[model samples]
Target: MEGEINRSVHPIFTRDPEDFMQYLNKQVSVLKEDGKEVTGWVYTIDPVSESFVLLSFTDDKTQLDIVMGPSVRQVSVLDENSETYKKRIEAMFRPPEVEALSEEELEKRKNVLKSWLLKNRLPVQVAGNNGELLSISDALFIEPPYGVENCRSTNEIILGRIQGLIKNMPSDQEEWC
Candidate 1:
């Protein structure tokens, strides 16, 4: 009975990733196993998981839906022309622009962060190739720019504390770069 239901849903379950590549960027109608229907533009389909990321746009807001492979019974392309949502979709997940800092400026930031950590009574040492990484008690490690996001650790409590410290630490510059 289960296999019969799957067969009735759609052959998409057995189809290859390349078979669904044609649906990318096009508006599509997805029929679910439970008989629910969803219509949206195809952002991407995970080649591994076979899940679909769908995009829906309103006047000022854009919504995203992730449909699992197993839940998707069938997928039908609604629009073939890609020009409409192509640019908007590309811009949706684009990283925000940031000014590039010079080697000297990066080094200065690193030094300031190390000093701040030491002042906080947290042991910190410069490590990594070209002394680019900061090792905190050989536990947490921080990469360049030395912001809280650069922190890496398995200990969630220490990581949160370190991130908090970085966030509240006073900066010499007017803008806490």
Candidate 2:
């Protein structure tokens, strides 16, 4: 609702991804070509297809609606529900909790990963203020525990390769460390 649009206009189909970002977590009323109106909180918009996903919440259930780009006649902001709806959307997709590992066990896992990377002849280094990060490349770093999920990289190719390598790492490889 920050950049509220008043008039009935259809620019959503041609709107840039940046424009869609503003609608995220905001209550919106989308007018379709057939006169059907959809009102919900904006969850996501597909950059490629321009289709947007909306979430409608009730006391006991949440409903999801995806509106196609071409069918949308107009999209107007109704209100901002960023704080409440954002948490709900996140919770909907949040992964289950995992058991916490002790600091010593976490350190050992990190060391094992570093050793494995070394064995594979991949460049690796300790980075970050507290030396808690494993730097693999300019755009890539693996957080503590050194698991695939902890790997972060701007480059998708590099990220995928590193995560795949870690996933396929032989069990005996840990014994070598």
Highest TM-score model number: 2
Q: Which window of 10 residues has the lowest lDDT sum in candidate 2?
A: 94-103
**Candidate 2 wrong stretches, greater than 4 Å:** 1-15, 98-146, 149-161, 164-177
Residue 18's C-alpha lDDT in candidate 1?
A: 78
lDDT values, one for every candidate: 0.82, 0.81
lDDT of 1 by residue, 1-177 (tens): 555554364455666767878888999999999999888999899876678899999998988999998898999989999778986886676433212555677788888888889988988999983597899988899986677788999999999999998888875631336
**135: Cα error in model 2, Å:** 10
Best prediction by lDDT: 1
Residue 50 displacement in candidate 2 (angstroms): 1.3
lDDT per residue (tens digit) for residues 33-88 in model 2: 99999999998888766787999999999999999988888999999757767767
**Backbone collisions counted per model:** 0, 0
TM-score, structure 1 vs. true: 0.48
